[model samples]
Target: MKRILLLAILAGGVVTNGMAQSKGNLNSLGKNDPKAKAILDGVSKKFSQLKSVVANFVLKIEGANNSVTDAKKGTVYLKGAKYKVNLDGQEIISDNKTSWTYAKDANEVTINNVDPNSSTLSPAKLFTNFYDKDYLYRLDGEITEKGKVLQNIEMTPTDKSKNVFKVIVSIDKKNQNISKMKVFEKNGNHYTYEITSFTPNTNVSDATFSFDPKKYPGVEVVDLR
Candidate 1:
């Protein structure tokens, strides 16, 4: 149970990634080769144009034996630096500064200050700002899956001490959106985040990123800030 809780927190934590300098929020740290830069530029530009985005995703955690240890389905709404994620037993809402994490099973909510530069992989970072300086990326070529052409971009973390060793991103060439992402961790644990559905230019309200305790009855709020 402790392990599961840890994983849940990690999944729900705030992660900072590099948004292109052109987008006015540059935080990337890795050196991208020409080909990688071009491909990432397309992704960066496409997402930067969105007022909001909503996507359904599946998270699979695999063990060392290549067996699935856990799997969960979730939905994410992202706008600017704000995001809200909904899973079966958990929900994370963040407005870029403040973050609220609720675990239904525990009937508890934890609030904290969101450090955008944190080196964790959050859903918000995965979709928009994943390709920046923390990863040295290379284009691994294109492949067709389900009749859609995907450009495979391989990313190696610049920080060797990090638990995550490598990340492979599959981008849809037609839309320049991320089709899937796989993270290889040093502890023999693998996480695969697959976008099952994507909706761009969504009409998400700012209130959606802020948590309302009134809506959740009989829940305890723990302020970690």
Candidate 2:
């Protein structure tokens, strides 16, 4: 199965007057702005230069009526293709090879192997040339908040059959790091992921990405990999 946890919470988009209603699928990517590509390229370059990342974020889900339905706070640790996320008593760890999903309530950890060529979009893959394909994007100008400038970019998927119809991404003007991402669904639901804090080149060990059942006295291990 696809990585359910990250896919459910994550994901990404803009100043378009109105979001286009997604219906049938499109085989090819649509319009891609050169300006957006340049800015995105810079974002990718900066992220590639980082040794590691420690970020705290919040996910807010809003209903069709624009009411806040649920919210969650989480932290993500990133080092190359390896990363770990702790959210709502659930831990997802991937060592660039194997993946460990631990549920605190169940006291069980499920294991799976990573597919290197798979275009699975985890938070770790969000920055590394992620916008170049299967997406049509454009620069939506900038926004200023608390004396900080954020560049806004709007994105729509080439495949219209997907549940997510659009995405709006905000990047810090100074650091070029991601500030926030808002994802819109076809069913009048949306998710917002705001990067509360970010630290690059943080010290993290390889062992941090690999969850060990032994560490937990009575945790059960389900090796599906």
Candidate 3:
């Protein structure tokens, strides 16, 4: 269960190109340049038009001296404010109001109330809105990746005390989509999330965002709400 949550949080903390500003929050955005704002807003507008998104990702956790401590691959389903993620032998389902994390090995499911504003990765913040409040952003530079031109943007958290100190997002210039994200933590660790496949407007039922424990026989439910 702990491993599942770690993956989810690591994936969710990633920021895509978007200008979804948090309400009454302008301090962190004061350093944003006009060019950077334009680039991010363009990407956000394009993503906002999608009805749903499905993507596969590769997550890598690096320790000191840039040694990769762990690597995992996962799939994510997103529609509106809801999301479902499958990583390792665990699954995370969120209906935008509540979240369920189920571990196959332990046959246990942990449920909790959803908090979108939490520093941790919440689906609500992951899909549609991010990075206008917590971090001050700027266009670091541009580069080429896999024959595609990508704009690199760097962000620093407003609160210096946060565990995550810096975030860098690599955006696909042609489509304005996030291709990769790197998070630098204060504890000398870093996380990287690379989007391997992205499909927009994928047909999916709302029920996919909710979990049904009955389907899994002998699953123990632990409610933390």
* Top candidate when judged by TM-score against the true structure: 3
Estimate TM-scores for all models.
0.82, 0.85, 0.87
Candidate 3: give its CA RMSD in angstroms.
3.0
Clashes within 3 Å, all models in order: 3, 3, 0
lDDT per residue for candidate 1 within 19-72, as digits (tens), equals 232133222643455675676677766766778889888888899888999988
The RMSD of every model to the true structure, in order and in angstroms, is: 5.0, 5.5, 3.0
What tens-digit string does per-residue lDDT give for candidate 3 at 17-62?
3343433234534646667677777777777788998989988989
What TM-score would candidate 2 get against the native? 0.85
Q: lDDT for each of the candidates?
A: 0.70, 0.72, 0.75
Backbone clash pairs for candidate 2 read 13-167, 13-168, 13-169
Q: Give stretches of model 3 more than 4 Å off.
A: 1-30, 116-119, 126-130
User: Between which residue pairs do clashes occur in model 3?
Assistant: none
Instruction: Answer with 2 or 3, whichever has the higher TM-score.
Output: 3
